[model samples]
Target: MNDPIVKVEKLSHRYSVQWAIRDIDFEITKNGIYGLLGSNGAGKSTTMNIMCGVLKQTAGNVFIRGINIRDNPVEAKRHIGFLPQKPPLHVDLTVEEYLRYCARLRHIPKQEIEKAITDVMGRCAITHFRKRLIRNLSGGYQQRVGIAQAIIHNPEFVVLDEPTNGLDPNQILEIRKLVKEIAEERTIILSTHILSEVQATCDHIRMIEQGRVVFAGTVDEFDNYIIPNTLIVTMISMPPADELRSIPGIAGVEELGGPKYRLKFTDGQDVKERIIETSVARGWRLTEIFAEKSSLDAIFAELSKK
Candidate 1:
């Protein structure tokens, strides 16, 4: 069987006396986009930095492919590409010049440098802007250049830290599309506090909270991590609060005004089915009934508590 592309075991880091991350562990075995999701100051950057070999961890190991980063950083780093939150852009150089320099830094063979630069530029859609000064490009195009540099060496794993942090909405969408395109042949670890960004771009998730990995799984699993307790029900004929509360699994009922009501239920109960059957039998004239989606913040809060 093929080995994992990345493995992080007991990964922890500390700044002064404060722990930035603690005992975080996970693995990436396939080619796909993985999200490192968390709030600001939730250790996302600290963890990414360690994984990319930018910062040595206070404790534990980060393995790229099969090499331990701490024991063979130079070799491990060759398989990794990193774009930090603040891009390491040399604004004075034109896009092609910067890419050439990056390719050399990645130690591409002298004869193969031009093709490497050309290929990465084409992949990142920055081919047309190759001769333009990076500082002169729009934020979206600059981001593309950033991505180009990260993958210039054709590394198998890439780490992008907040790749669309300050871009406008359209730019964000463009970058997301570009990222998805880039991930087709390589594993990408994208760190972001934006929930929608993860939902839009990542196939898997590793959610961190308060210096620890609170959850790690597929994107759909993360979305359903916290079982929804509240449901929105709209009816033509409203029932008394007492009657709605009496339904099995319903712990509470709230009148949301108009024809709408909020029903709260326990985690394991088939409250919706019961509500539908009860509404039909009693002729409450049910119009709509659906579970309330827990907000990103609420999910984060719940995971943190756990």
Candidate 2:
């Protein structure tokens, strides 16, 4: 059987008198983008630093493809790539020069270094800026270069901390596209507090709040964490509030003043189907009916409380 790509067990960290993260755990077993979601200072960076072997944990262990990171960091790190919050960039050097230097740091042989640099630059869409000094590149291109450095070694797992923290909206979209492309062949850990980042880029999420794993699951699961209790229905000919409440699944009816009504339902109720069927039978003329989904911001706030 193949080993899981990454496994974090009972991870904890502390700074002097305060604990930053405690008893956190999760696993990655495939090649896709997984988000390490949390607010600022919510221990996202601390956790990624430990997983990539940049910082030692106060307790627990991290494994990369079944190899213990602390016991054999070199071997474990060979399978891992990391781009911290502030990218480790040398702004004075040209893009190609910087990538070449990174390739050397990863210990690629001299014979294959050029091909490695060329391939990575192409993949990152920065081939045109090869000779451009890093400092001259825009924030978006610089971010692309940062991503390029992280994956220069083609590691199986990559950790990216807030890769889009300061870029404008267009740049954020570009970086997100780039990250998705990179994940097609390798597993990526996208650590960020941005709700949309996770919704748009991640296949799975592990949300942290106040130094703990408040929620962990697929994006759909996270979004549906709180089952919607109300649904909105609009009709050309609306029924009386008490008449609508007489339906089997509906617990209460709230008249929304116009042709709209709000329905409250108990758990395990098929309210929509019942409402539609009743509307048709009673000739109420149902025009629109759909459940109102909880917003990501609401879910984030809710999870943080736990």
Candidate 3:
């Protein structure tokens, strides 16, 4: 039976004196697209490699459907298919030959190999390019082949590292579509530092900062959870940071100098209106007040910025 659950408990990794990832824990239940988000070198790849058994973590463990990766590597690995940032492809092999070879490598039964190849090709939208040599295809087509290879074994969990790292905008869109289509039946772990791509395609997010998880939550929850207290206030006159802190819903204020101020407020209060009304009653001249919308890009920068 295919079970699509992955759990990482107290996951940690180090390189000599440098710590790459530390004390990260999260769980994936059921099937959906998950994005592991962080800035470059924040350890997204390190964690993914540990999960795939490519690099051994100095401590902690990963579980695939309750099977510990260290305890039962073969059985645990059989349930996972991984595509690293740079895909391994043979330049001379046609798309058809390449997929057939991948099937053999995964030890797919000879009798079912043809059906597996055809299905993965169709899912990746590479059936039209089946006869073209891998080297001859565009980056977009090559990426499709990489994805097809990962799924050809029909693994329950597919891990893709920076699947759209170098493609043009149109190619990125196509890959996102293919990722969504693939996630319908199996779980996927998408590791990337790019925010726009994750915002457009991921269902859940695990935000890694300096090799540790700063946040783990659903996409919707993350936006609301992180942004409820963030706002921008542009005014001709501003109150003292201490006075502004006393306003309902207003938890903290940072003076950006000149005409700009950043405000942090909790939900459940009309923070903007209260600020405006209070300013008017005090005869403080105002110009503009705006709430900064939460975007994956901005949120990631805030969490990972030094």
Candidate 4:
């Protein structure tokens, strides 16, 4: 098995009298997108900052490609590209100029600087804006420029904090596609509060709360953690709640709206056929009746309880 491209163990960070993050741990394998999910002020940024060597951790260690960041900061950093919550952009420079500068800063060979800039710009789909001043571009285009700088070095690992924070639906889709394409060869760690973003883009998810990882696994694992034996059933025809409750295997039911209900069931039972039979016996007009797995939003809410 290939070693993890990024490993963070027992990581902790403090701010004067406060602990921003505590004992966080996770790993990222090559060529996969890992989602870091948490609410605001949940230490998502602090953890990302520490991983990129932008902020010092009060305790613990971060390793990139088997190199300890604390012992060899420069070498460790050379293998990482980080985009913070607010992307750092030089508004005065055009996209091409800024990227060329980044390539130089990343120490790409002088002879390869131009080619690196051109390649990354094209990879991020910002080639059209190469000659445009960054300040003059739309937020989406500016974001693409940020991405271009992050990947210009062809780092083995990329850490992006809220990459799709402020974009319309179309722009969000475009950036998501860009991140997916980039993950083909490099490890991408994405941190976001947007549950849909994880569901749409991540192969695995790690959910943190109060500076500690509460859950870490694939999307299916996260969903199962919160909703082990649950199903949502919606019907266009209104049925009496009490009568619906009489079904044998149903453990509980909650009315969601005028004609919707969320049903919980005991383990080792399939309730769909029973629900159908009940509807038929009562002569109820059942427009729709199907079981649904809980969504990521539901899972997050369930996991973040007091």
Candidate 5:
């Protein structure tokens, strides 16, 4: 495999007495979307800042395309594009103007700045709003403009910090589509608190909690961290809680009000069939019987506890 587009090793950052991030290590491969998930104040912003050269790391190193950011800030940064939670839009300027400014700042050749701006505007789906002042455009359009600026120079890596924050459902979907479209040939690190966004857009995920990486792997790997080989059986006519607990291979049962029970099974047990058979034998109606797969929410809650 090719070397990672972005490499972080033992990265640490602190704010005075409080440690915002501690000894985190991860890599962003080429041409894939990586989700950085965490709850509020989970040091996600701090980590992104350090990786993008916006903040100094207390320890560890950040390399962009094999170039250490600290050793060669300019060259390393040329390969990266960043859009913060709040886009740094000049509300007074038109979308085209703003993108032109970004192209110049990124050191695109003077002759190619116009063409670069045009291309990024189209790519980000802001071509229709190119002449509109950012202040006058809708929230979704503003976000498109922000992304346009981020990719104006065609960087190999794009980092977006909560790009969908503060948008309506429609706008969120639009932005999600835009992120996916842009990720076809570039590495994208999407940092957001919305787990659903990660589920929808990311190929792999790294879950951060209170300044540490608690989970890192594909979505399937994260889901596997939750209870394994467990099934949830809901019945409308469940026996008395204690009687339900007596079934074979039944390790435990949680009563969830009015004939509803969650049954846990022992390893290598076909508890579902037994529950169905017992219900049928007793002439009790089984309202719902199905296997339950672990959701990302359950996995995140479990990891956050650590």
Candidate 6:
């Protein structure tokens, strides 16, 4: 098996008095998008900053391809590209100039700087805006520039914090597409509070709360954790809740809204077929029967309440 591209162990960070995060641990084993999911102040920024070598963790270690970030900061950083929550843009410089500066700063050989800038701009779909000043670009275009800078050097790992924080829906979609395209060869780690974004973009997810990882798994697995065994029902004609409750192992029939109900079951059994049989036997008018999967919003709410 290929060694992990990124490994973090017993990672913790503290502010002046309180801990920002505590004993966080996880690994990125391949080239795919990994989401550091959490709410505001959940230590996602702290963790990302540490991984990018922008900040020092109070304790523990971060390794990029077997190199410890703390012990060998420069060498470890060579394999990383970072886009912080607020982009660091030189507003006076045109898109091409800023990217050229970034390529130079990243130590792209002088001979290849122009080609690197053109390639990155093309890859990020910003070639047309190359002559536009950073401050004159739209939010979406500016974001593209930020992403261009991050990938100009073609680092092995790209760390992005809230890459789509304030964009409109179209802008959000565009950036998400850009991130996915760029992840083909780079292991990308993205931090965001947007649950739908994680569901839409990431192959695997690590949900954090209060600076510790609360859940870690594939997107489908995380859905299973929240959903377990459930079903959604919309009926035009129906039996009394107690009558449906007569079915074996059903915990409760929850009224959702209008004519819809959310059925909770015991032992995580998927009894949609049995429920269908029962409904047909009763000659009930069932307009729709959907397998219930809890929304990420619901899970996040539950986590926040804890």
For TM-score, the strongest prediction is: 2
The positional error of residue 79 in candidate 2, measured at the CA in angstroms, is 1.1
The model with the greater lDDT, 2 or 3, is 2
Q: Give the backbone clash total of model 2.
A: 0
| lDDT digits (tens) for residues 1-306 of candidate 5 | 366799999999889989999999998765889999999999999999988999989999999988899889999899899999999999999888888888889999999999998798888878888888899999988988988888889999999999999999999999999999999989999999888999889988888899999988987777678655556566656578777777788888777677666677785357777877988898678888666677777778889983
- RMSD of model 6, in Å? 2.4
- By lDDT, the candidates rank as 2, 1, 6, 3, 5, 4
> 1-306 in candidate 2: lDDT tens per residue?
399999999999999989999999898888899999988889999999999999999999999999999999999999999998888999999999999999999988999999999999999999999999999999999999999999999999999999998999999999999999999999999998889889999999998888999888999899899889888999898778889888877887888888988888884466678888889999999999888788998889898873
Candidate 1 lDDT, 191-274, residue by residue in tens: 998888999999999989999988999988888887788999999998999999899888888899999998899844677888
In model 5, the worst 10-residue window by lDDT is: 227-236
The list of candidate 6 runs beyond 4 A from truth reads 234-237, 254-261, 267-274, 285-288, 304-306
- In model 2, the clashing pairs are none
Residue 27 local lDDT, model 3 = 83
The lDDT per prediction is 0.91, 0.91, 0.88, 0.86, 0.86, 0.88
The parts of candidate 4 lying over 4 Å away from their true place are 228-243, 251-263, 267-289
Q: Residue 176 in candidate 2 has what lDDT?
A: 93
Question: Candidate 1: where is the Cα deviation over 4 Å?
Answer: 267-270
Instruction: Provide the lDDT at 267 for model 3.
Output: 62
Give a tens-digit lDDT track for model 3, residues 1-306.
454389898999899999999999988888999999888889999999999988888999899988999888888888899999999888799999999999998989999999999999988988999998999999999999999999999998999999998999999999999899999999999998777777899999999999899888888877765544578887776677787888888877898888788988886368888988988987668788888777656676677775
- lDDT by residue for model 4 (157-184), tens: 9999999999999999999999999999
TM-score of each: 0.93, 0.94, 0.81, 0.87, 0.88, 0.91
Per-prediction CA RMSD (Å): 1.9, 1.8, 4.8, 2.9, 2.8, 2.4
Q: How many backbone clashes does candidate 4 have?
A: 0
Clashing pairs in 6: none
User: In angstroms, how far off is 132's CA in candidate 5?
Assistant: 1.2
Of the two candidates 1 and 4, the one with more favorable lDDT, higher being better, is 1
Show pairs that collide, candidate 1: none
Candidate 6: lDDT of 5? 90
**What TM-score, to 2 decimals, does candidate 5 have?**
0.88
